[model samples]
Target: MAKLYFRFGAMGSAKTLNLLAVAHNYRQQRKKVLLIKPQIDLRFGANAITSRAGLTCDADLLVSEKSYFTLKGNDLISHDSLKKDQKNEIVLDNKLDYSCFLVDEAQFLTKELVEALYEITILCNIPVIAYGLKTDFRNFLFEGSKRLLELSDTIEEIKTTCFYCEKKATHNIRLIGEKPVFTGETVDIGADEKYRPCCKMCLHKLKSR
Candidate 1:
């Protein structure tokens, strides 16, 4: 049976870069790997999956909040083109040919979709590797991460040290320029400069008056 793997970290933890490398390795071995990204990720472009370290790839699929995800890439392809283009029609026709599935910013996935992904792994026998932050700046678990925690067979923390301490960083605190702030939407998008990774001790100190 295939396993669901959840690899999580705070901001600037190189999760996306790691994901790209995994995809690269699979392709280099002559295996077909499909990359998936949630549509909420606009920091790089809605459809492109990019890492702060500069590695990039065109995600083979984009997942919407209310969409059904099969092991196939049919959900992301345009329907009109599917009708006009014979090549595309054939691609969607037998969509289970993908060897692997990789998702970046997996934290943005909807609860329903995460469950679907879990099923895709269990029944379809495809390994699903998900990368994203476990918690927001407010130190609360994102919906996708929450479900992933409960569903994944293997859970690994992509290790990055706290910017302010030697302890392994598990918290993300948003910073505007240089100041640590406690305000913002749960899923605000920004470059590495806008967020800092911290350990629990530093986060408590910063949060306390």
Candidate 2:
């Protein structure tokens, strides 16, 4: 049976790059893979998933909190592919569509949307690999990440180094102009400019100063 896999990491963990690499591998093997991202993540642009390293790919589905319900049945992916006139249609043998579902920036997904993704694994019998941060800069669980932690068939951590320490980074620190601040909006999005990964000790030290 296909499984739902949640791969989580701190900031700068190369999650999107990993998603793109897996998608590339599937295409190279002549298999269908569906790339998905939340519509809220527009740092790169609508329908685009770009990595810090410059690797980029257009998303097959850009889901919103409200629109994610479309994943039920054959409507969500197949219809969108047709509407976009995408060259690489997800269908196989004129029936099955997308052997795998790969999602990036999954932390933006709503709880209901995460449940829908769960149903896709069971109802569609396809494996789903979702990648995103496990927590916000405040160390609080994102609704989608919380659900994923509870429901995913498998959970994996993508490791990265702390900026100031040798221990594996587990927390994300929000910075403005190189100054770390604990007060701000939870969902402010940016790359290296706004967020940095840190270990528990360094996080404490920075917050204390």
Candidate 3:
């Protein structure tokens, strides 16, 4: 059965780069892959997903709070060609289209959207791989990440080293200059100048008292 996956990490975890590479691999094999992104993440560009490492790709689908997702592509090709057997295994369409779905900057996704994605994975029999930060700079879980944690079939963390120390970074610190800033909107989209991947100890020490 197809699965919904949540792969999360800290600020500089290269998650977007990995997502792009996976999409490329699928397309290279002559398989169709849908690249989805939250409409709120325009840091790179509109309808584009970019990594701090400079990799970039245009998103095939831009999901908003009110947007509804289905198995149809931009070409209006319906995925109704598929059928399920008595054993609950999904039989593919004659063309074997839509190999997978990849989502970038998924932390801004709404809970309803996440549930819809989960349904898409199971009902459509398409694997959905989502990449985003597990928590905000304040160490609070974003709505999308929280829902994914509960609904995802698999959860994984992308590893990165702390900017302040050699420990594996598990926390994200919002910084303005050398000091940490604790108050701000939870969904600030930025790169190295605004956020840092830090260990728990470094985060505790860096936060202003």
Candidate 4:
């Protein structure tokens, strides 16, 4: 039976790099892999799935909160609300041709979308691998990650060291310039200049200062 797998970690953990490597291995074996990413992640580009390590790939599908999925015959079709023309709907038909479904930045996905991916694993018999941060900078579980933790057949952690020390990083700290700030919007998208991965002790020290 195919399984829904969630691999989550703090920032700079190379989650997207790992995802790219998996996609590479599948394609190398002559198997088809579908790449998916949330529409909210524009850090690279609208359709680009990029890693900090400089590896990138265009996502096969971009999903938003308004997107939905349905199975037709052997095909999985996604109906997206990205178009302003109400009469013409945009559809992505996945004819069950792919051996696996790989989603990047899975934390930005809506709960409904995660459930749809889960259904694909069971009904379509395709394994789905989702890579993302488990929580936001505030250390709160993202809606998508929360559902994945509850429903995923397997949950794994991708490890990375704290920015200040060698301890394993467990939390993401948002920064403006060089100082850590605790209060802000939950969904601020940024790279190294705006965020740092910190262990529990380092986080406490920074917050105490």
lDDT of 3: 0.81
In candidate 4, what are the lDDT values of residues 2-88, reduced to their tens digit? 999999999999999999999999999999999999999898889999999999999998887777676653224343434534322
Candidate 1 per-residue C-alpha lDDT over 1-209 given as tens digits, one digit per residue, 9 for 90 to 100: 88889999988889999999999999999999889888888887777899888888998888766455433544432333233333222223244667888989999987767887787776678888999889899878999999999999999989999999899898887888788999778988778788888999999998894
- Which segments of candidate 2 are over 4 A away from where they belong? 70-96
Give the poorly placed runs of model 1, Cα more than 4 Å off.
Answer: 70-93
After superposing candidate 4, which stretches have Cα over 4 Å from the reference? 73-93
User: Pairing residues by index, what is the TM-score of model 4?
Assistant: 0.91
Question: Which stretch of 10 consecutive residues in model 3 shows the poorest summed lDDT?
Answer: 83-92
Please give, for residues 75-97, the per-residue lDDT of candidate 2 as tens digits: 43333323343322222233237
- On TM-score, the leading prediction is 4
For candidate 4, give the lDDT of residue 90: 23
**RMSD to native, candidate 3:** 7.6
Q: Against the true structure, what is each candidate's TM-score?
A: 0.87, 0.88, 0.86, 0.91
lDDT score of residue 47 within candidate 3: 83
Report the poorest 10 consecutive residues by lDDT, candidate 2: 86-95
Best-performing candidate as measured by lDDT: 4
